[model samples]
Target: GPYVIPSETPRGEKYLSRIKLSWSTMATTASCPPPSVLLPIRTTTAGARLTSSHGSRAGHAVTTTGGAAHARPPLPMGMARALLPQRAPLLRRLLMAGALAASCTCFLLVLQAQASVPPRYDGFAYGVGAAAWKDAVLVEAFLDPLCPDSRDAWHPLRLAVERYSPMVSLIVHPFPLPYHTYSYHACRALHIANKLNSSSTYPLLELFFKNQGKFSNRATSSISSTAVTGEISKMAAQAVGNSVSEFQSGFSDMRSDMAARVSFKYGCTRGVAGAPFFFVNGFLQPGGGSPIDFSTWTSILEPLVAHHGQTIEMLTSV
Candidate 1:
């Protein structure tokens, strides 16, 4: 009927968030007969004692609705105690205490983990690139759209994706930290371009990065969803060779924030502390130069293209 508080219980965050200490009380009735005495006869005592053949037994009937429906005899050895008031109070106190302690411990552990992981993006993630280098190779690049080093590593991948076309697919992902102020906006703008034209996404992205800092971080981050649509529409006019209407449509229908989240998540998963990070076929490339070396990238990709060619030839013949 009333609430019960448990003491000394292990703590958990979820458990503490929305907790209700309630007890459903039920009532019970019992009936019991008094014990019958038997008299014993002795030669000196000369008195004979008689005992009843049927001994008194206690009986009970309980109902959840306060036992209003029925009543029953109580057993001589049986006891009925209210669970809510009698037992639940003590147990609730214990439980609440333990829960608080456990929740605190887990919170501390999470803080420790965050400390070691190097905060990448507590707010919005920015400055990473990912794309498909064709079915032959999946390219994952981490970059700071604002960082010169990241831009350096990014240019070659963009070029290869353009030059190679279907021979390769480029997937660009980034991990932007707070230190790089405009990284997120830059990455988001590129993502908006990618959404507009899946085929020519790479080159358009190169152009955007090539023409960086047109908008301030505060300006881009605060941009409305409708405004993003308009911005992407302008991309097609900037030597983008894509339909302005189509790009705007994609932006209108897209979840740009979630796009940023996925980009950040992937980069962080690959142990990226900073940009520009590159993973060619799950392999990490060193960063420190503007525009990654095409030779270094081809050293890995060319072989993959060759293998892919053989595979296609064999399959077609079959």
Candidate 2:
């Protein structure tokens, strides 16, 4: 079966496309040595005849009467011989061509192998020692801070991360849904907290998820965006143990807004359509938008952790 490489990013897709074009060009032009090198004629008693020992014309004969070589029907190799002075260059070209083709084939096979494996997660790590363990399963949670479903998933997801300990790493991406009026502000607040104190990120996320009702669209219907952000900054500052004034200052910093926007844009690239989305080892898990339980997460992660452990053990033994 043909291996289909999952597209991780637009840049990666462009890189793969360029490699494909190079492969195609190599296939068409370098598949065989030049005809001048492979089809040198030998003067025989019968006539001037050229014999091919490689490529499409392998084991065939060509006869020349005048100055031009003419193709003949397929015949036996009785007349084929090493009767040309260009034999050394011919072998050299054949070897060079063979080596080139083999290299391209090996490169493609390596790419196919990589395509079969799930991509490793590369994002901001959450929680203590979340990314400390080598070969840990990566669990990415894309959540809108004010989304009800995200709140519901928080507990079980936290429990799963704790249960797995160093064997699993969780990265929380703040994906603010457009419909949620204050979701973007909430996410920006979380990012501000992260910048203030790296360890405070998850705590602030938990705080937002727990008190999401206070910042819901209905609750803040009459409030201006500035008022909502001010309220969120208070909560973020308290959660991260920073001064409210300092956190509010961060809110005004364009970098915090840019960070939040980058997070949202990354979610879009990952095809996140709603809150509480997930990716296990970079493969999107369908139906992850709904809240998942601790038991369900365990069921999905146990075998994966065990397999990873076994792989490590095998590699060490070897």
Can you give the lDDT of residue 135 in candidate 1? 51
Give residue 272's error in model 1 in angstroms.
Answer: 1.9
Q: Quote each prediction's TM-score.
A: 0.45, 0.61
lDDT of 1 by residue, 233-266 (tens): 5754464566667555554444655676667766
Query: For model 2, how does the per-residue alpha-carbon lDDT over 1-318 read when each residue is reduced to its tens digit?
Result: 222333455664585467557655654564533333345444433333334454444434444334455554442243233222334567888999999999999999866644222133424586665657446888889998899999999899889988886788888889999898888888888778877898888888888888988998899999998888788888888788988889999878998887887788678778889989988988998786798888889998899989988988999999
Number of backbone collisions per candidate: 57, 0
C-alpha root-mean-square deviation, each candidate: 19.0, 20.9
| Top-scoring candidate (lDDT) | 2
Note the Cα lDDT for every prediction shown: 0.53, 0.75
Candidate 2, residue 189: Cα displacement in angstroms equals 0.7
